[model samples]
Target: MLWEVDQKVKEAADALHPSSNVDHMQNILQDTLIHCWELLLKRHSATMQIDAKFQDLLFRALDYYVVGRLHEMLWWLVCERCQVVDQLVKTRLSHLRHAHLSALQLGVPAHYYTPLPAAVVELASLASVESAIGRLQCVHSTIELIQAQAKEARVTLHQYKDQEGEPELELTKEELMALLTTVVVQAQCSHLVANIYYMTHYVFSVTEDDPLWKSLGLLRNTLENIMKLDVARLPQPAKSIRKELSLQDLMQVSAEVESRFEAKGPSRSIGDITALDLQLHQLTQQIQLSTQAHSETHLTERNSPSRRSDRTMLSPTQDNSKSHSFREFLSSIPSSLRESLRRRQSQQRSAIQSSLNG
Candidate 1:
């Protein structure tokens, strides 16, 4: 039945040219979905009464299958006609494939398996659409939810064995990246490159300072970093049963295993937002350090020791103006770095006060 649906979808996709508009593509997909749904219902009605769980699974499977096939067809059309796949798109696709193969090698334990979060699935689905605002909104909401979960230590670490103690409040960057790689592999969404290209070409009202814009950047970086991660370095399941399977073999096994399990109740959260936040902070620090070094060099070349001393010995008004400028600079820093700086400053003040009292 699925093969029949697949054939029909392929036929519909075959009719589309590389220059087809978004609506033409959407209409083909929408019509295919409606037809597939009716076909599935008829087949199930003859055998057994479809329960909610089965229905949910059916639709999800259909969505993934139809969308994936359609995307492949569209990708091939573009490649055949345009004679070029964007280099970044090719890199991402390669990364996703590599990550999937690495994950298969780990042989993650059944009990440890964490299904992709619903929001993450929705994020991928929205990326396929043409609506920039809608996609941005979904991205923002998804990142926010993932951040909340991470803060609460609720994101499951599938690669690690369960411990007797409470979960750690903070996750390291490696752990976060490993979990993200797993989620992306399991998502199996197609046309990632095309979706990203579409968004890049479309102009929207987002800015660099906005959290939404930051979230978008974080997501893109996460996807890119997938290729760089070494699955062997991540914490392994204690009882993993290693299997030597080819990529095709692993994919087949995965599909079979997935079919056996009903979708687990929202098994885990998504996004390594904390890891990305730390990355952003490190980047900001590097820029600040470079600027400071340049300033120091320029100051050393221009100012004599006596002049430097005179400049340092400021009046109350000059000190106030300097402090105001410093505050303004702090305001421009990313929130995470600003908070870290605030904590460090408070700790230093406490230490100085204690020393004076002593």
Candidate 2:
């Protein structure tokens, strides 16, 4: 039944739910296939030519239905982010509890104070992606009692007595301000990464056919004016949310173009793909140059934890040779802004150094 779609989606709503398997995710994917089949095969065929009334009515209905669906999806995103936070809390607490128990058993009460040294914060700075950065931020926020190492890898601990008068770590107001800013910024970056990956997969899926790949890639890139996957600037918190939203429109346009070109109606071409091909090539070259600059920057520096993530993530050295879709997308982006991206990276390093020096 069509209601199974809603039921399956409900099951996946809780990311921590035990039954939330890859199969449930597949069910959601299959739900889309089912809808496509129903629309193509089960629906009654149009008996006559499209009428003005039907067209007008359809547009009006879409205005209401589409808006509602957008709100629903947004709510879903909020729920997903909350679940991510929940999982982080559970995981961290589980570790802390184990450490606490171990300390009690060993008769070394000091181990209960801080299980792991705050130096790991330095390690966190090199998180492979922004989403990982965001998830780590959530973990940092939920537990007020933990050692935190700042940018210079110096551990700062604010330990006080708990209800039992034992020592515990805590965050101060100023520290909270910094941590909250990081949490929010990391969350935004994570969302941006999530959307980018989602759009990448969506585009690749639509363009997987023999004749469509090159043209569709160009069409999507043209619509987005994307150069180098725009990776360099994301280290800075987004200036405008709409900037990412516009990139998101790339996939929407790709989807629309796909439905039109592949449908079983009057065959039409969106003109020559030569221009599109040239554009894609130029964009990819630009990104490759940018990626190289980013890599050089990576070699020259290592900084505080928060800043470290951007450094390594900007030019991922791991597994780019793999034929994965996201890797291919990142590797192919043109680096027209390679110099600018490098300059920004330099500025960021300077700022970080200044912060450390201060």
Candidate 3:
């Protein structure tokens, strides 16, 4: 009876009711095994397959059936050893339950185990060989969502065209290009934001600071760089719109990313040159604070040990080193417009000399 039920389960394919049929078979086999000690050796022998060892042969047969093998010929060797069938059923059920729970936790689709009738493929980006299967599952969900949306849009568009005339559906060439550009820019920004948020979150969640934090720091720097680049690249209206939208909300989605990256303070991930200028102002303040606490002279210029001058008075080595470092720092300040800074300083010095002469 257990063997017959197992055969039926195999034939059912996706329709297999393991909860009812499979469990029932396992229980019947377990009860039979518990009572079979009183039976004659010949009576029990008739139940066993051609193999001399009844239980061992049944185990091998049951192994073939439980692992999704549907054919009956593979189990001909152990037809009556109920003990093997019970173990196989228990093992299979345990495996299935584990897989189902894991899938549910990972937001996998319900039919995750119902293998697609196609050749299996692999992805290079998959974390491991096993992840290829998970990625395929993600792809399946994405495709389903896309299909549903496309179908709904098609129906709505057809109805709109019928009621409003085909001419109303067409857009001007410039309008179409503008719409496309807006879409492309938004898509790119969204991708960058996602990368920044995840990378930041991954970095701060670690207990011991790993080199991965450097990678995260690089990402944060890149985000700052991109924000500047975008500000410089995007049109004023678009830049204003982005500022109005609040880029911090994007970073704040993941908790760890939010904790590591402050939305307030002087540093901002995106905006005008003014925001970056504010950060530079803060750095200059820190430098002044350190110098006031330690250095005797205002322009001691303690940058490199090799470049440090022995004389308390300014020397070419100290002056040149300070000038070089200041220039290097100013190079990052785009709007300071170096030529203007040079001319304005020269003008100020002339004004001071004129006052001394008077």
Candidate 4:
């Protein structure tokens, strides 16, 4: 089914452009995905063995699927589905929690495992399940954290009225996405993939139409799409309004600013107002100059490397002096004698240098 879908999608796509069908690199990804799916669905214990192979195929597919903003589209689709899964999983887990607790309280073991009398065996099974659950929970937390960050990101992407009172985007849409952000989403998918691999050992003969198989199929499609599409051209939404801020707390500051702009002397003359305006203009220039100077100082400090007093790289002259001083100290020893031992290190150094020069 995976192969048929990919093949038909390709044929339909290639029908428009004849050359599109000639991409030999495309087969590697499709072949690997199909092979992995076959392993997972039909064979026992082989799916786990070929996980690295599946992951490798997905990565290599990146080179082949360099068209139609596919990478960007796949990530967006994957994240959307992942977000959906997160909510569903959370709700499912909440409902299942009491049942699980009650089971533990009643001293019941997890179903699908061979019942044994040994205490150690039961504990091991519980531990294994706990560990697996921990991994899934970690992935859940990652998705939640990403969701929280995305809310703030949406705020940042909101249309803001600029100083000119014209709507402007604070940052470009491209700048909003971090390069490795997709990797976090992929890791979440991998967590599920691994759990499924573990589960397949007990469950037998999952039909192609099974919900579990369908989800895996969808995930595989997502991974495949991530490889081929042109990620750069994914459509970005127009900036939207978040909220309007018209706080009453700014009244005092607003009044002060109005007073500055309209300040006058004792005489209700135009000249006094003119003088005040000149003073305000000079103050603005002074502020700009001060800000520029501070910025330069800050940049210099940030770019310069910090120096340490205790340890530092020495000059060749310093190294030569240190060696000579150490030789002098060694020469002071009676048993060591004067010249030979003292000059030994220096001679060796000189010989090595001469050899390199020669």
Instruction: List the candidate 3 regions with Cα displacement exceeding 4 Å.
Output: 1-130, 161-358
lDDT of 4 by residue, 212-247 (tens): 444333333332333222322333222221111232
Clashes of each: 0, 13, 0, 7
User: What clash count does candidate 2 reach?
Assistant: 13
Tens digit of per-residue lDDT, candidate 3, span 5-120: 45444444344333443333333332232222112122444335233355333432332333223223212212222233323322322322222212112222221111111111
lDDT of 1 by residue, 279-345 (tens): 3334455655776788755422322223233322222222345334433432332322223333543
The lDDT leader among the candidates is: 1
TM-score of 4: 0.20
RMSD to true structure for each model, in Å: 26.7, 30.3, 34.7, 31.5
lDDT order of candidates, best first? Answer: 1, 2, 4, 3
After TM-score superposition, what is the CA distance of residue 287 in candidate 1 from its true location, in Å? 54
Query: Which pairs of residues have clashing backbones in candidate 3?
Result: none
Of 1 and 3, which scores higher on TM-score? 1
TM-score of each: 0.34, 0.21, 0.16, 0.20
Alpha-carbon lDDT, every model: 0.47, 0.32, 0.30, 0.31
**Model 4 vs truth, CA RMSD:** 31.5
Shift in Å, residue 329, candidate 1? 34
